[model samples]
Target chain A: MSVTAAKGFTAAGIAAGIKENGNPDLALVVNNGPRRAAAGVFTSNRVKAAPVLWSEQVLKSGQVSAVVLNSGGANACTGPKGFQDAHATAEKVAEVLGRGAVEVAVCSTGLIGLLLPMDKLLPGVETAAAQLSEHGGEKAAIAIKTTDTVHKTSVVTKDGWTVGGMAKGAGMLAPGLATMLVVLTTDAGLENDVLDEALRAATRTTFDRVDSDGCMSTNDTVLLLASGASGVTPDHAEFAEAVRQVCDDLGQQLIRDAEGASKDIKIEVINAATEDDAVEVGRSIARNNLLKCALHGEDPNWGRVLSAIGTTRAAFEPDRLNVAINGVWVCKNGGVGEDRDKVDMRYREVHIVADLAAGSETATIWTNDLTADYVHENSAYSS
Target chain B: MSVTAAKGFTAAGIAAGIKENGNPDLALVVNNGPRRAAAGVFTSNRVKAAPVLWSEQVLKSGQVSAVVLNSGGANACTGPKGFQDAHATAEKVAEVLGRGAVEVAVCSTGLIGLLLPMDKLLPGVETAAAQLSEHGGEKAAIAIKTTDTVHKTSVVTKDGWTVGGMAKGAGMLAPGLATMLVVLTTDAGLENDVLDEALRAATRTTFDRVDSDGCMSTNDTVLLLASGASGVTPDHAEFAEAVRQVCDDLGQQLIRDAEGASKDIKIEVINAATEDDAVEVGRSIARNNLLKCALHGEDPNWGRVLSAIGTTRAAFEPDRLNVAINGVWVCKNGGVGEDRDKVDMRYREVHIVADLAAGSETATIWTNDLTADYVHENSAYSS
Candidate 1:
């Protein structure tokens, strides 16, 4: 199940020939519903893709009937012509669905600074339009993948309503917002205001905390569409919980499929003076090259962990800090503690707990270990 | 010529079993001068080494007679005992040189979170003092090498006076003093105030611009000692220029010796709205993992260059930015321009020029390409 797992949505993926490899490169998801309301989160990078610039405008209108997406070419840094291509994509989707251009959002991912093949992409939109079906969510998810090894989807069904979503990303995955393209669909009769509030809150905690490779994307976009087909108005708190669950699941999938990573590391910062301090400490550890390398080697090198934390400005006394790796407190009071030999590293998941010993706040950020494969994959090509 | 190239200075290197491999791990540089004026710079990292904390106090006294350095272990994150160890090392040097303890400076590098072996280090200082000579600069430089394959030193002789320096760093090199340990000595008859001004001005542009691995150390220190034995005062502007040249030369050497790096990359950000903008953009490009990997593979991937620049807050128009790789304008007006194949990557140096088209300010940051060897060296064991 993907975007179409919720009621009143149809999706399709088709070969667009945009990629020279001739893989499926076009995807369309239509909200054929009694209510067309949506919310969106986009890349915070200053250099945005043309599609992000266009979708930000469409979301301002507080309505979205469909989304058009493609792979093989990220229409970023292509100047006026790139923006025109994205606008044309939205216009074509709106024309096929008998809606206004402002009601459609577009996303593109692949190599940057290149223009898309509008000749094929625009016509391929028509093919996807013709084949739109409620059971085509998986194909839509697969079409948007760049280096992702697997298509990701999640669904949370309540008593009478359901929330479903699909996401695609594998590299250039850092917060803000991980080069990911995602679409979440729900059939609970919520207004545009409710959808916008819930989307921002869910994304801030879920997608915003996953830092796969410490590279921010220029084409990250996550759109949440409400169709109101089930006519079951769930409680606001319950609806938000369901949406968050799907987002959290998709974010986990993104980290699990991160490029060339052998282990998934979860950095949990506890006893921070504030939430910001916790986040700062967590991010510092997540982006540390030496620490990530040691994690890949499974050395349980707590020294590197302390060094990474020392680089951050988080509030904590140097001698009061504590670090535990996989339930073994290898470092305490800023010195060597338990036997590092007791720390086992036989699993795909590594849990590192950094206790600041300053306050009661805590936060967790997920990242991956650095490996030779990461260097080889990143150096071999322009992906 | 190294730290002892200047008049009235003596240096030595010795081994006292501090390093398990029995390599020389102790160095001493003494200024037996008519004027013992000095200035220093230390790591800006919040978590500083014990030696850094000790030397910062020494510099505040505005005079330095000697500097003691070691390569076997960094007294960082070792708590109060570490601080006491650094103090005792300095006191030992002071006793041997017949100077006050407050007039001695200390520097340490190697692993963090471990205490130094005082039994080995203290006796090693006495051995270094016994063998000190004006011709022992090269030996002192070699003693400070950790992963550096070659020792680095620079000399500049003026009319009747000379300036000389030595630096050692192979990894954990980044801005905030470039994770280096350096010592410069001059016999130019300059006072402490003059030395301080010139040292800060020189380091601001030279050492602060090299970002080899985007990792800052907790024990980075650069010290300048003035011995007025030549008795010839150079012009203020000329003196600062000479200091800057020595720093720039040593900084370049540090980058060349960076661990596992196959290519030296110079990222030049030109035509920015302000000097800060230029430096920010230059540093962003220097730290980009994807672009570094692309350079390692000898692929002229200019799109990655643009993507890296987009992640910065520097003033630039997406449609007006231009990029040139090794004299080939591969990207112009934020889009593809020259044929990427025209660019050559056969050399060990790759120069990237980014034209922001916003103003006249410019800056350049030096970095190194990411390689599989980098991963292996950093992952094989914790430093």
Candidate 2:
């Protein structure tokens, strides 16, 4: 299962002179199919990008056949001009593919509020269209990245059904609905309602649980398209689980590639009175910069963990909470229980478990350790 | 004014060996007057620290003669034993000062959930008692620091009345209520109710508007003591404003001293429909790490400003919002309108203004720019 493995899909990526480094800055994915059923989830931020606003309205018809994405210049905050540029790109893609403009989706990332270089972007789109191929998925994935050191792609397969996805986001991640740009493709037939349900459920625990820096993005979007090429549609529960698996995998990759992050951390909260409470507890810890930095330094600072958990409204007596760092129980019943020296956080993966001793509810959040590199990358980002 | 500038107060600082570096860790502040009228505030976190819990109970009587604070171990989650240590510390202070144990307040800050070093603490208390003086405020301020680059102090005087305070907190300073450990002294003759009202009002607009990293501490406490030695008490309104001024000054100093901070940022939200709306908008921008980093780099990233403002429930039309970074109107009517490069951010201070176009209500928040030093400081902490 690959981004272009689905039937009737062709993809291409190329250097568009948008990025300073001249890396692949343009990507295009096309659907040369008889069916166009699409759904998209956008950022919950009220201050949305012009492209997001345009696509949000366009996707209301539940039909999308192609997507045009570019890096190095986020066509956001450009107002009417930005909106027109997005519409023009969609029209250009539709003209080349002999489809209506409304059937095309557009996504842009990079420095915000910058106007797109349409001279380069239009020709780049043409070049991408001319070079479109089924094996272009990997290149497309590499084209949409900003500070990410690695490309993220995932695919799920089960009994004649396939779901492939590619995502790009390294910062401005926090729990809400979506935090980045993701395109998912499936060859299995799915009703609009089924797709919506599966997408929402998949995002609830995956993309919605990643808080890299607790900064929500304005251009975050996730689109799902079903081609029904496999002629096999699993039940709703099964299909939802498969989609969740894909989202989970992609979400993990996003965290691993977080800006200046050297380690991926998982914060798990268990035995909460309610799922929301558990999630709140987990997210609170995930968003704590001090805790993230301490984890980056391989310091088992259980005090920060307890302090973070204490800020949440979860129903747990402080003394009844047990905390484990790196698989070593450093705190039990709200007191020092294990030797601090026993916890080793020298690797690129760190895990923290908190038992609330209330009920059988749990939540796990993915995050990245805060480091000087993160500060450096972000501090100098806009310059 | 200094910590010891208040009449009838004696203070001392001593090394307790609790910190590995053997820095001055134990501090004592005593009120020698017969009237022990005190008002206090604790952290807003539901998970109270042991010292917070003990002090909360003691402050219920509105009488406190002395406060004993120790840095290096914030005995927050040490369970019953932690509470015992706090009580024992207060008892030792009371015994040394010949006051009732119930009249003593205790506070601790540093790593959490560790047992107190009884040998070091007890001897340190004795040494502090022996060294107590009317001019030990600077020493006490330096004693209760953890990762703080400098001490914070503020004083306000009107006529024959005086109010002075010292605060210690550099991080974990998001607002629920209070975010640091502060002690205020006054020689004005005021009742407990007046002091309480003034303290609450001052904290609401001061400490409550500072968001360093969006993390709230468990051991945050603020104590206000009035010795009535000045034999002069101004009107309640005038005294309250003075207290607010002092708190505001200290709050600004705290933001300036934020870990790895290179610039102090002020986010002002104006034309909100209500005060709450204005505060929410201000806080959203103050908590955005990307925006903070952009400020650190002196880049006028108005897109991040809009995205952050969009996260709040403030009743404002997105398209009607206007934004200015460092006095340069970078965005007008929710879109870029001015030359972003015209904004100058070469100074250590920054000002961001968001016009909601709803009403006349306004709120301002103080924050710090994210920097590599912040990451390094927090990452290496506890290591």
Candidate 3:
């Protein structure tokens, strides 16, 4: 079941002439509420997009009824007009759905700093809202993508509760809480405070740990809307765990689909002085492009790995650190230990384990190998 | 005139058995001064090579008479024995020069965490000392290269003084400095404190600002040695300026020879509220692989530029950001303005200007385009 399969939600996607390719560019998702509890996470980048700023303010109410997203023009750095365009989109959505304009949220992705073609957008929202249906999650996922080869959707079912989500992102992925645009829906009865707490906790570990290319986006956001339609609120702990699993699954898919990526790499930092240190070490390695490229080539260049980990301020002595790639111990007690040729990287998945030997804490980060395709795709992205 | 041109200095480069290619992998430089005075800068990475730690300790006295470098093994994370190897190298150099071991420094770069081949290294040092000469800067530069296609050397001549240097690095380059190994010599009468101050200031603006691949190295070191042989001491201001020019020239050379780089990019962040903010903004843009790749493809994707700028903590409203590429104003006040066709990126050099509209502070960072060759070269770097 897709995200829209959740009770009390309807979604629609449509072509709006915003893209020159005539692909679908508008998506609308509405909460058929038994409850309107909602929470959101936005990009931490100080330079934010117009739609991000607007949504951040709207989310202050901790309540939302609908979301309107458009792809093709990011509506970022478009000055005051960009904000106006976002508000106008919300107003149009509210007008069509007979709801307050403030109850609608907006997101835009594609090229940044370009004015959204209002001529195509206004009518497109009306069409999307009118065509909204219970099974439109897949279409909505496909509409809000640029350069992504496929749509990403996930669902989790419990005894009496269910959680579902859709995500869209191909590049500009990094840490800052939420790294991309993800919309989650649930039929379990949940309070606003509980949903907010759970989302923050899940995001801190899941979406926040995916670093595809270490480029943070201006429009990254994640929103969760709980309809309480099932009237069977599971234990808060169970719901939170389920939410994390959904996010983890979708995050993995995003990494798999990273632009020009051939392999997905998982870096685990263990025996750290603290959880934060472990995460910092993992992130340091995940963001190193040279190491990532080396992984793509299947070269167990532990030197690059050591160099990456050394860049972080995490507490660890170089001599005590241990490194293993693909389960082969390449270095032990800070020195070469295993034959590099014994480690193989022919598969699409790669794992690297770094032992800090300082404490007991551990953390893992997911990333993709840097490839020539990534360079080729990005170099001509704006052209 | 090069680094070795300084009076009271003898240098040599020779091929040791460390590298499989049989390239020149060992180098020796000695400061033939009545009173040795030196200052060094090492990589800020927390994970340091064994030689780095050893040298860092040996440089505490601010007096170094000799430096030994090898380019086939990093000797990092090799535990206590690695430290012994570095000390032994220094002892060997000192013994041949008839000086104390404490007065010599050591550096290594190449594969990390591998034990030094003491059998080959000991004999190689003796040969290097026997062959040391005044005009060995060219060979010394070649000795410390890994993937670099050419040697990098720079010299500056003032009214009564001269400063010259050589460097080796072609990959694993980024802010917080690149994976560079540099040796500088000056035929100027200066105190240890003065030389340290000049080196710091020069490096902050030059080597510290060139980020080729955003990967910090564990064995980055830049050492400056001053000889009173010239008997011509100039004002501190003049000496500092000369040092800056030499560093700038070498830094540019490094960028020109960066791996697989089709274009050298200069990113300028102006009108920032503070120098730190300006640098942060400039570095953010320089480190964006997507933007670098876009520059390679000659696409004026200003959206990517603004998006990269948005990732920094600089104080600027998204709408007020102005960006120009290749002298053409592609984005003004945060929105698309001039015709993108007017911006041409066909040349090997590209300039990007970002106006923060905050204040007067500014910073410039140098970088290279991301290409397929970068991936291909780095993938097999260790093997």
Task: Give interface RMSD, every candidate, in order.
Answer: 1.4, 1.2, 1.6
lDDT of 3 by residue, B181-231 (tens): 988998798998898899999999999999988888888899999877788
What is the descending TM-score order?
Answer: 1, 2, 3
Lowest summed lDDT across 10 adjacent residues in model 2 chain A is found at A1-10
Candidate 3 docking band: medium
**Model 1 C-alpha lDDT per residue in residues B144-246, reported as the tens digit of each score:** 9888899999999999999999999986788888878999999999988999999999999889999987888889999999999999999989999999999
Model 3 spans > 4 angstroms off: A177-179
Best by TM-score: 1
Give the per-residue Cα lDDT of candidate 1 at A6: 92
Candidate 1: segments with Cα more than 4 A from true spot: none
Give every collision pair in model 2. B260-B374
lDDT of 3: 0.86
Q: What is the TM-score of each candidate against the true structure?
A: 0.98, 0.97, 0.96
True contacts kept of 1: 0.67
Backbone clashes for every candidate come to 0, 1, 4
- Per-residue error for A278 in candidate 1, Å, reads 1.5
lDDT at residue A218 of model 2 (Cα atoms): 74
Please report the candidate that would top DockQ against the real structure: 2
TM-score of chain B of 1: 0.99
